[model samples]
Target chain A: MITSISLPKVEKKNDPSLAKFIFRSIRDAWDYRWAIETFVTNNLCRRYRRSALGFYWGLLGPLMTMITLSVVFSMIFHIDIKSFTVYIFTGLLPWSLISDSAIEGSQCFVSAESYLKKLFIPKLFFPFVIVGTYTVNFLFSLTSLLLIGMVLGFQWKLSLLLLPAVIAVTATLILGMTILLGVATVYFRDLSHILGVTLPGFFYTIPIIYPAESIPEQFRQWFLLNPFYYVIDLYRQVIFKGQSPPIQDWAVSIALACCLLLAGLVVLKRNEQDMIYRM
Target chain B: MSAEIQIDDATVRFRIYRNPSPALKEMAINLFTRRSSGEVLEYYALKNLSLTIHGGERVGIIGLNGAGKTTLLKMIVGIYPAFRGHVHVGGRVTPLIEVGTGFDLEMSGRQNIYLNGTLLAHSRQEMMEREKQIIEFSGLGEHIDTPIKYYSSGMLGRLAFSIATMIEPEILLVDEIFSTGDALFVDKAAERMLSLFDRSQIVVLVSHNMNHIEEFCNRVIVLHHGEIVNDGPPAEMIDFYHTHIAGRGSNASTEDRSPMNTDFSVASPSTAVSVQEQSRFSMTSSLSE
Candidate 1:
C-alpha cells in the first residue's frame, strides 16, 4: 500500500562523522514529530478519557500522592506543614519523571515493535514520546509547586533563571536512562518488571521522603555520590531554600548526563537493526 | 528522480531463538556459569544474492513461501542487516510492505491518516493538505471520524489502500497489497497504483498474483530456494516460473538445469561476483551480532 511514501535519502557514506549521526537521529525524530505529539496527547487523554475531570487527572495523581505522603510523614516526624510539602514537592515531581519514564519507557520499544518492522523509524522515537508525555505532567506539577511557594511568601530569586538549565540536565539524564532501558527491554522481557520492583527500593534510598539531615553522619558521604542527589538537592535549594546551585553541582550534573547519553546512543545504534529480528 | 542500487553478494541470516524469549535472568546467570539457556538456530533467509537496480526500472519478484521475497525487500530497506555483503541504495526509498501495519486500532481513521503518513515519511503539513482528498477517495465519509476498530475489515482495508496510494514517492516497494479491497475499490486502487507507477522513478513489487506482475513489471525475477534463479522479461520469466519453479512441487519431472533455462537449475548466477573477488560494495566487516 502506498500512503504518502516520502523517505529520507539513504546513502552508504563511509566513516560517517559523529555529528552526522546526531543530525540524522534528531532529524529522523523531528520528521515524525507530529506522530510523537499525537501519541503523547492520546496517552494523556486515554488515561483520563472516562474521568469527569479529564486532563486535570494528570495533576490529581501526583497531588494526591504528594498530599498523602506529606500528611503522614509530617505527623510522624512533627515537621512543619509548609516545609514538609516543599520537600516532597521538590523531590517527588522529578522522581516521578525518572520512575515513570523508566517503567513506562522500558516497554516502549517492545510495544512499538510492529511499527519498527513496518517502517524504518528511529528507535529513539518511542522513548522521546513516553518521556515527553510524562514530562508534560511533570511540568504541570512544577508549575503548581511554584504557585504554592508564591502563596506561602517564598522568595523568587535570580537563581530561578537557572531552572531551565536544571530541567535540560534532568531531561537529558532520564532520556538517556529511558532509552537505555527501552533497548535493553527489547532483548530482556522482564526489564519492566525489574524496574517495577527496583524503583520503589531506589526511591527509599534517595531520601525523597525524609530530609538529607535525617541521614546518619556515617552514611552521609556515600549519599552525595547518588547522581540524583545533585538533581533533587538542586531542586530543593532553588525552590525551597532560594539559593543558586553551586557551579560544581552544575558541572557534575551535565557531565554525568553526557556520559550516560553517549553510552546510550552507542547501545541504541548497535542494537537498533537487530530489534526487528528479536521482536 | 533516480535510485541506483547495488547489493554486492549480500547474505542475510536470522538467528531464531528456540525459546519464545529467553529469560534475561537465566541468560545472565548462564553467562556467569558458562551454560546455555536454550538452543538457537542460525539460517540464511537470503544467501549470496546480488542484484543491481537502476533508475526507471520496474522489477517484480516472484517466489515461493520461504524464497526470501520479504527478506530481499527488508535488506534493501536496511531493516535486516546483511551478514556478508553490502546493500547500497543511493536515493530515497519508500516501502509499502505490510500496509496499515502500525495503525492504532483505537484511534479514528482520520487521525491514523496523520500517524500512517508520518510513518511513511510524509510531514504533518503534507498529511493536512491531503486529508480531504484521502477522505474523499477512501469514501469513509463520516465513518472516518469513528474509531477504526469499529470499521469493518473491508472498510479498514479500503482506508489503508486509500492512504497508501495518496501520494507517489521515489522508489516505491510494494508487497501484495493491491488485491484486498472491494471489487470496485480494487479497480480504483489499481488505477491509483498505475498512476504511482508512472510517477515513481523505480518500483519493486513482490506479489503472488502473477497477473499483476505480468501487467505492471518490465523485468521479473524468480527467487527459488534463496537465490535469484531467473531474471529477464516479465512474460518469459513468468512462464518459466509457472512451468519450472511453481511446477516443481506439484509435478515430478526434471526440467532444464541451466541458469538461463526455464526450469529450476543448479548453476549459480554467473553475473554475480565470486566470493573471492570483491566488488566495490563488498562487506569488509561481518555484521554477525
Candidate 2:
C-alpha cells in the first residue's frame, strides 16, 4: 500500500508581514461572517430565551435605568426632568454598549474555549460576535429612545441622520477595546476581574448620570482623558441636543477607534496561535 | 486542485507554566523581584515529525493516549501551530474532531445545523439550502425543532455527523467520532462514513478499533511519544501494534481494543471474521507478553 511517490519539496514559508497579517485576519473574518452572524443571533436569543418580555428586555433594561437615573438626578440636582431624561438616555445607551463589550468581550475567547480548541477560527471572530451582539442591543435601545423622545415632544433634528455614523464609529471603538481586553484576559485571567471593578468607576468620570456642563472648570481637561466621554458626547449631541457633534469629537473618537483596533489586531496576530495552549 | 498534506520536520511545543495565568499584582511583584516569575516547563507534543499524505489515501493513526495522535490531526487541521517546522495542507480541511464541536445546545437542532455549517465555512444561504437534507438524513423528525440540549448523545452524534459530511470535503480528518446512536442510526452512520471515505480526496482517521482501521484503511501510521514509530500497510501495522505496542503492559483489553465492535453486525461476514482473527491474534500476543 505504501507507494514511493516523490512529491515536490515545499519551501519553508516566512512569517507573514504585519500588513499581510492584518489583511489575512480581515479576510478570515470575512470568510467567517456567517459564523459571526450565527453567534450573535444565538447570543441574543439565549439572553432572553425564557423571559416573558423576550426582545423587549433589551429595550426595557436601559429604559428603566434611564428613567430611574432621570428621576433621582432631577430631584437631587434640580435639573429639568424632561431634558435630563433624554440626556441620560443618550449617554446610557452607548455607555452600556462600551461596557458590555469590554466586560463580556474579556470573556469572549475564554467562553469560546470549546469552539476554539476544535477548529481554526480566527481570533477576531469571537470579539466581533461580542461587539456585534451588544451593538444590536444598543440599536434596539436606541430605537426606543427615538420613539420616546418623539412622544415627549423632543424636537426631531436633521442631525438624527448622523446617528448611524456615530454608532458605527462607536461600535468600531468597542470592537477594538473588546479584542484587546479579550485577548489580554485570556493571558492574565485576572484582567477580567480588574475590569469588573474599574469599569463602573469609569462611568462616573464620563458624566453619564450628570450633565457634562456641571463639571467644574478646572477639572474639564480630565473629562477628555476618559475615551468614553468623547463617544458618549457624540451620542448626546445627536440624540439629546439635536446638533452635530463638533469636529474634534468625531476626530477624537475616530482616532481612538483606529488606535484601539490596531492595538487589538497586533496583539491578536502576535499570540493567536499560542492562545489555545494557554486556554 | 489535488488535496495533499506535507509536514516537514514539524515540532509542536507547549509551555506548561507554573502559574498559567498570574494576577496583575503577582506580575508586578515579580517584575521587581530578583527571582524569575513562575517557572516554565516546555513540553514538546510533536518533535521533528515528518510525513507526507497524498490525495486518494486513507491514513489511519493508532497510538496510546498522550501519544500525540489527536495532536498530529490538530496540527494538520491548523489548530495547533507547528512550533519549529512547517505543515502545508494543499486544500481545505473539514475536521470531525469531536461530536458537536461548535454546537449551541440551547439552540434547536435545526438552528445548530446552520451554526455548525457556518462554522465549517458554509454561508447562511448554503446552510439554508442544505438544512432540509441534513435534517432528513439525521431522521430526527419533529424533534429538530426542539432545543438540542434535549437531544440524547446518540441524536447529537447523528446531527453532527450529518452536518459534517454534508458536502465532500477535500481533506477529511476524523478523531474517533463518538456516534453511539441506535442500531439503525449506526447503520446509517456507517454507510455515510464509508461514502465519505470514498468521496474525500484524503481521509485521515484516528481510532483505536483495529477492525475499522484494517477494514477501511489502506495505510496506517503508528505514533509513539509524538514520533512516527512505524508506517506501512494496515495488515503490517496492526500486527506491529498488537504484538509490540498494545500487547506490552498496555491497558487495552480485547474488548477495549475495538470500540466499534458492535458495528460488526453490519460489516461483511468476511470482515467480521477478520476482526475475530485479529482479536484472537491480539490475545495470543498478550499471553506471550
Q: Using lDDT, give the best candidate's number.
A: 2
Model 2 native-contact share: 0.53
Q: In candidate 2, residue A94 scores what lDDT?
A: 87
Docking class of 2: acceptable
CA-lDDT, candidates in order: 0.75, 0.80
Going through the candidates in order, their DockQ values are: 0.31, 0.37
Candidate 1: pairs in clash: A2-B164, A3-B164
Per-residue C-alpha lDDT of model 1 across residues B1-289, encoded as one tens digit per residue: 4688789998876665555367877778878998665555556678899999999889999876556787799788877878777899988787777567556777788988987787676778989999999999988999998988787767877887778778766888887777655798888888888999989888999887678899999999999766899999999998999888777663223222211112111001221223112211111111221
Instruction: Give per-residue CA lDDT, model 1, range A1-279, as digits (tens).
Output: 111222212233243556676677888898778778777887778788668999887776666676677678779989886677886788888887888888998898888755665567777788888878888878878877776656655566777777887888888888888889888888788989989998889898787878889999999999888878787777777777778878988888898888777777777776665677677
Give the range of the ten consecutive residues with the poorest summed lDDT in model 1 chain A.
A1-10
Instruction: List where candidate 1 sits over 4 angstroms from the true fold.
Output: A1-20, A68-78, A151-155, B28-34, B251-289
Error (Å) of candidate 2 at residue B266 is: 22
lDDT by residue for model 2 (B137-220), tens: 989999999988787767877887788879878899987763457899878888888898899999999987788899889999
